[model samples]
Target: MQPLSSVQYQFPLQSLNTFGIAAHAHAYLRVTNTEQLIGVYADAHWRALPRLVLGGGSNVLLTGDFSGLVLHLALEGKQVVGGNETHHFVRAAAGENWHAFVQWTLAQGLGGLENLSLIPGTVGASPIQNIGAYGLEIKDVLHCVTVFDPRDGITRTMNAAACGFAYRDSVFKREAGRDLVILDVTFALPRSWQPNLRYAELAQAVAEQGYAVPTAQQVADTVIAIRRRKLPDPAVIGNAGSFFKNPVVSRAQCAALLERFPALVHHAQPDGSEKLAAGWLIDQCGWKGRNLGAAGVYPKQALVLVNNGGATGAEVVALAQAIQADVMAKYGVALEAEPVFV
Candidate 1:
């Protein structure tokens, strides 16, 4: 087993999370390969301790100093496994940057991921969230997921169907998923690429750009452009992409809300439910560009809550709670946080 002494103590985590909150971990380790990961689990010193498995640290909000072992997966390798002339199979380890992987696939002439460009986080974390943007979701292209089950010291692959994907949710987010660590993810890309412009904003953007039929590259560029205009960059100002999921409500509830606020933005879902824009709800509640202490709602997008510099995790949580309360009182819908709290 690897030496437990290699674990860093009282590690500062301000730079690790996107929120830029001041936090620390009791212990930390960077596992670069499955052997190293196994070594960590085998070590008696760390075996009984509480553990936090983190990826790019984009999808998490650190509430405070954690009294547990923080494991950062850094495993790296990627390849085109096998495919016929019409399709190709691409795979990447957990540590791979998600955007870079998307670009690499585009470089190889693959096109399904164009709409999901510029999303922050790692490849392994993608399947867990079933991350989606523009009009495409990872579930649309994911072929399989390989995970290391620490409980039995076994690694296995689960196909796309078995991943149980939903809108920004999967088996990986449930209780049964805690013991499994994602090792790598495989995607099925089609050689006969098609650009997706299902989202009205995206379709309008492409049309405004004077393209009746945009290529994959053009679609990706448009998506990045839209995101930049709508979301705060984690590098410049600290924030997770979106603070809340769009609230899905029954048709009767949506109609009731529309009666009160005729300008409410909503989308009809396949299941007959209506999805109300969480950002719009927050904005309507006058939370945009507002703050509770140092944590504030992003001016450009009400969906994002930002650290206006020197904000504590508690302050961010406070702002989120305030917004949730106001939105709930006004609209009778509870806003669910998008990021994982640790």
Candidate 2:
């Protein structure tokens, strides 16, 4: 981590994370190329390089100083590398800003990424979490991801099925995914269009906007508006967007809940599974806007855990544990976190 101004010392990571939690890194690196990463990885200090990969830093909550090297991806580019019967292949660098890339795709007349507008983070981090918002997930648009294997020190690409995409998760996030450092990602976006209006709020926006059959860009605008209404702009207030993934349960488990709370809301999947509204459950449990120490649930959205200043990572983790334990005990359903804890 020496002889490199690209690497900084005692860097405050508060501005990096959306939640704006003040923290520090023993050392930090802004890797703009694979060669740069390999050079650093080959150092004899490899055994001691406290490594952390970063993109937009939106979906993370920084509770404390990371006693390691945080490598912030700064490489950026976008292009169309392939095509298919109806969909065209659009490729983006790992460090490319996600929303900017989505807007670019819309400008190029691509359709699939529109619903993902205004989502924070980078293209590299998107696949690992299988990020979803407004009824659409990254898996639907992913063709495959090209990654540099840190273990074997090689490059490879894995297809969608191999990603093992599930609700807000993928194999990349699994034990294997951690070994893979994302270099770039390729998405399959349809050239011809069929706008997805399956999301209730989106449809309502279409109706309210008087768009009989909204164009792809129009859909994106409406979705952006709705998201702004729900999720706080990280610039204005510290936040990590939604802090928990929706609890996916078996049909039988969902049936049990429905029997108890007839007005319970859920979205059914084709695989005979159902996704419970996690925000609803949190609110029903009366955790919304309730502060514990310095960490608390967002007032408007329960699933979003926010820092009200002076909160430590331990405090945040404690609050999350309380919420998880309460839900498990009350409804027999477990809520999982979306942020990857280091």
TM-score of each: 0.97, 0.95
Where does candidate 1 stray beyond 4 Å? 84-86
Clashes of each: 0, 2
All models, RMSD in angstroms:
1.2, 1.7
Candidate 2: where are CA atoms >4 Å away?
1-5
**Global local distance difference test of model 2:** 0.85
Query: What is each predicted model's overall lDDT from 0 to 1?
Result: 0.90, 0.85
- Candidate of highest lDDT: 1
Pairs in steric clash, model 1: none
lDDT of 1 by residue, 81-153 (tens): 9977877899999999999999888887778888999999899999998999988898999999999988888
Error of 2 at 10 (Å): 1.7
Q: Where does the lowest 10-residue lDDT sum fall in candidate 1?
A: 1-10
> At residue 237, what lDDT does model 2 achieve?
68
